[model samples]
Target: MNTIAEHIADFLKEYPPFDNLTFQELSDIATNIRVINLEKHAVLFQINDLLHDSFYVVASGVINLTTIADAEETIINKCHEGDIFGLRPFFAKNNYMMTAKAREESIIYAIPIAVFRPFVANNSDVLNFLLENFAINSRHAKDNVNSNGKLISDTAFYVDQQSEMQYIQSLAYNNSPLTTESNSIIKDVAILMTESMVDNIVICEKNNPIGIVTNADLSSKIATGRYPITETIDKIMSSPVVTVIENVSLAEAQLLMLKNNVTHLCVTKDGTSKSAVKGIISEHDLIVAQASNPGVLIKEIKRSQLPKDLKQIRDRLSDLIQNSIQKNIPISHISNIASEINLAIIKRAVELSILDLGSPPARFAWLSIGSQGRKEQLLLTDQDSILIFEDVAPEKYREVKDYFLRLAKRTTSILEKVGYEYCPNGHMGSNMLWCKSLTDWTKQYNSWMNTPGENSNDLSSIFFDYEIVFGEPKIEEVIENVIFKNAVNNTLFFDFLGNDALKRNSPLSFFKKFIVEEEGPHKTKFDIKTRALMPLIDAARLLILNANIKGIKNTYLRFKQLAITDSKNAEIYLSCAEAFLTLSKFRTVEGLKNDDSGQYINLREMSKTDKEKLKNALTPMKDLEELIKSKFQLTQFS
Candidate 1:
């Protein structure tokens, strides 16, 4: 009886739903608990299984909530000590959407729903929390996108859930468009239609639509010589023009188009020819606007000829990221897609730069530094990179160097034109020192490692995320190998890197207020980049470097891998990864709000609750830095 009460209390204390019950109440409930023991792979609940009077809580071991993911049996969530299971049946029609199986020999507490219902009915907060969490947990959006993989939905929920996605397919158009004078000649009227790319040109007097000349009018009257080409367009135009007002919904627009058998709709101020036409919305525009495929955004970026268009694409990308985040995308998939978008943007920038240069003297590879190099950059920040060219003899070095330098300068200028600010520290490829051959880069890295100094450390940081944006893939691999080989077992270097990484604590105080920067560009503001992101970023880099790991350059993934390897620090590292996601979200939002990098936060404007949460988040980051310092023996270096 004592063990039963203690076990129930133990499990209740760890989870929210049961936490509402007091010890005496829980003890009274626990006495009637039915403890069930199961062997490995034994099913606790199956699909369509009738409601069991009792819900489950893990008491002695682990349970796997297995579902179909990517076409195979997969465990989506693991339930451990004090974790509840089989509750989907209690609140959700008493049928299991997923099967719960014991991963090993385990004992589970069966808390009868009959006794729990009364407590839940009386406690709104308890009930509300369960309801919300249950939806979030059970739907678990990452695996639900496609319905075919085992434990994953492969049926394309991203495509399937259009209504849920809230996409508005229709373009708002105004009727009663500004039209040419009724007596305007064919050439003059034709120019206006051509410039506007309108299918039809409206003829008006006093800016009031009186008639419309479409493609048919030009073909019949102008081409057939039924009327002279130089004659007034009023002879060919159709009179009694139909008009509509702006703010029509997609359905209404479609209906109007169908009813009038017209391909274009003119939106006006008052839905009459007497009112000025605001704009035209074509059927093609409406269809394209409805496109849900993410690829369209990339295509738009590629086709953009101006900086403002690319900027709009970037803004769209931000919206896309927020959508993915809100839709509960797995961070991995989100980063992967985002990385592709960044590459597309950079590639287009490179293409534009190449166009500007007219022609290149030699083959070269453009490298992206920092987060971008790692295939992990999810946000735009300072452009850190260099240019690597094929080798040139000493006599010809200046010729080759000048050519690449000019190219690099043009490339960065175009990227800056597209909104990636140049590196404040002059780490961009345009720097003469940065435009080097692969051999020079390899040799340079060897020198940095052998003769390590503060400058070398700074160089190492820049080189760590060296991703080749253009040029030969082989040379990029060669440069990477050189850096990796030198970095491995370079304990002194790791110590230095570790010390640098842990130098800043998370940005908030124990009291949860932003720690104001003492001086420099952000003297009055909170420097979130240095104090919050950089510390975590540096720690992740050291851990990955120390492990001799490659490819996973994103900080979150680095910490995730570290957690898998370092059992002792697994929880701390996992929490760090979560905090990073939250912090990244916060920073991105802050940047979007203020039109800066979002690194320099304005603390005074933040809500008290937010300040408290921000402060709370920094502790884990501080602890993470401490762990890195102790693990790497960075204090010895300090």
Candidate 2:
């Protein structure tokens, strides 16, 4: 007695987009669906086929999506029951880039795009799901595309619905916002605004927003005697309205607003004022879309008075990282956000310390070294920082040194309380050896560069990536100039750095098995940081320093720039960057899972897919190591 549509609706309801819809809506869509049954090896669609009016959902059995290159078919993904495919029509107007065939006897439900697009446009969750998956798939595909033109589709294998990466997620702004001509009377605009219930209106000239007038503008300029109510709207409007493109994320919008010191952002056709006005985003919109955005956390960090208050905010960062990883965000973007939050916490800690110690005797800068310096410290880690105060007179040296040391102690102590552990090697601002005047810091670098030794090389690895987190940047600039001068054409120092880099054994063995720790607490566990990540980091630093590249500190970024500077070995450098990002993501995920630093991984516990992914990520390390060996002439060192 069951209707076919009802039976189809019941099956479709178990999946997403459909699951998010009401049963009635699902049933309605089912009525328009065309159910097709196929025998094993039967093709549903082929590459270069014209766009279909409907996309598919596997109702039963398996569908293998593939692409052909060099006359060989490569399986891109396997879509099982409840899986969706052929979604290219939803996003693009092009013909199919892939072919979908039945791996076994299969039943597919083809849902009309006309019926599905409304749900996508109206529902945020459904739209986010599709966009997130498609974007992730496209990104990974792009990254893995080979010279032979075969596109690898690893990310398309799974759909993750765990957490919304709202910070990076495209904002949903008011597209049909109220607008008024700049020549319009202020009184007329006010009445039109009162009826429309909008707090602000874009003042336009030929559909392009020239300015914006908000409630504040009306109150400050018009409400006051400065501008009469009868005056033109342009008389009170804020000129050259801050604008963002349609795809601007909540975090970006917040930063743009903060940077420009405006409460609203005008969304334009081309991200400029010259383009057509598309929409507007107010601070209220950002607050509503808030899901652990860096801007919000940064505001909290600056406002926090006590270290404990900052700790509470710091603790929330792990969750942000977890969600971002779940959402498969690029590691670079995730690290940048984490770094901003980390810097803000450090800056705030310094502010609180300054408050406690009153005013400083001399100008000083707080330098973050190591992972924090490179802006890649995603998880809570050691505080590796140095304090460089301005050089003072010989008579005032003790007094100035004493003041900065006290300041360093106070700031580092606060950071420790906020969860960044004290550097075990004493590479901290609080350490008297690290906390020095600008002159001493310069002399220290010169000594290390002139005489390359074990201790100096170890220190070089950590300190060379130094970036100023707080205080006078001029102090850091002086130190940077000194380093670049000493670093240029310093073959001996680069060889030492290279020798340090090649110290770690390859992550894989002769049989391509993971070379894990053989003994101790981490026995049988793979050291991801030491074996996989450090080699890339070390190689990048050595090459960047050798190439005399300045300012780029992040390992992947260093490699990317090196690709440009050393085009002869560009492929190897690019692959190293890709591998580093993949490995970092694995480590971050493992760390988040185990609630630790994620340096070591228990290979036995990993899934087959995860192990394969990790293995694929490690493939470039061999090439990177060889490049270092030849470039640094490590054969002579050996």
- Highest-lDDT candidate: 2
- Candidate 1, number of clashes: 31
lDDT (tens digit, per residue) of candidate 2 on 462-486: 8888889899999988988998999
Give the Cα-based TM-score of candidate 2 against the true structure: 0.59
* C-alpha lDDT of all candidate models, in order: 0.68, 0.81
Clashes per model (N, Cα, C within 3 A): 31, 0
Across 451-492, the per-residue lDDT of candidate 1 in tens digits comes to: 566465355575776677776788787877887898878877
Q: Which regions of candidate 2 are displaced past 4 Å?
A: 1-291, 454-460, 636-638
The 10-residue segment with the lowest total lDDT in model 1: 148-157
* Alpha-carbon deviation at 252 in model 1, angstroms: 20
Residue runs of model 1 more than 4 Å from their true location after superposition: 1-286, 291-293, 304-309, 318-335, 356-362, 375-380, 393-395, 457-460, 510-513, 518-524, 636-638
| Pairs that collide, model 2 | none
When superposed on Cα atoms, how far off is each prediction in RMSD? 16.1, 20.0
